[model samples]
Target: MSLRDRLTEDLKLAMKARDQLRMDVIRMIKAAVLNKEVEVKKDLDDAEMSRIMTTMIKQRKESVEQYEKGNRVELAAKERQEISIIEAYLPRALSQDQLAEIVDSVVRETQAASLKEMGTVMKAVMAKLAGAPVDGKLVSDLVRARLQ
Candidate 1:
């Protein structure tokens, strides 16, 4: 089944199970997907859906960090719970070593040499690593380390 279908099914399950946290997160995801579809006037494929999920996860992570910094532990914990629920729909994350290997290959393919070529290298690496759970910041750091 497609990601959309799976999410819909899970939404039903969450509702039936009275899982408030899961239901809230799933509803948020659905809203984001629907908004994107409406904006683009097209149905999202698995890759597009995965990108949406990634964005949602990123937003939650940022919220968690901000909340923690502000000493709002309760809010941070809530964000963490949302993150865990959203992450269940993502593919297994790539290890740092694996991410590094792919980044190396992309750099080689694009002939990206030096920090100035970082953007080009990042675009290529993201394309290759699409649908995998690789952290963008980590990838950027790796690319910078490799290029410089």
Candidate 2:
């Protein structure tokens, strides 16, 4: 099923199950997707949807850290819960080993010889990993370590 259809189905189930957190998160995702369509004037494919969800997860993760730093445990936990719910609909994440292997291959493919060529390696890696859920930051760290 398409990501949009899956989201709709999950939204209905969340409503039936009376899961407020899930309901809210799904609604937010739908709204974000709709807004993007309106803004871009086109329907989003699964890859675009995955990228949006990844951005949402990244935002929530940052929020969780900020809340924790402020000693707002409850708020941080809520952010974490939202992240889990959002991630459920995203593509499967790559393990560190898998990510490292991909990064190594990308570096070789791009012939990235040093840290200065990090962006070249990153672009190639992102292209390779497109539609797959991998954190950009983790990829950057791995590439940097390897290149350095």
> Would you estimate the TM-scores of all the predictions?
0.93, 0.95
The TM-score of candidate 1 is: 0.93
Model 1, poorest ten-residue lDDT window?
126-135
Q: Compose the digit string of candidate 2's lDDT tens values, residues 38-61.
A: 999999999998888889999999
**Which pairs of residues collide in model 1?**
none
- In terms of lDDT, model 2 sits at 0.91
Candidate number achieving the greatest lDDT relative to the actual structure: 2
lDDT of 1 by residue, 1-148 (tens): 8888999999999999999999999999999989999999999888888889898889889999999999999999999989989889988888999998998889889998899999999999998887777789999999999999
Regions more than 4 Å wrong, model 1: none
User: What root-mean-square deviation over C-alphas does model 2 reach?
Assistant: 1.1
Residue 140 of model 1, lDDT score: 95
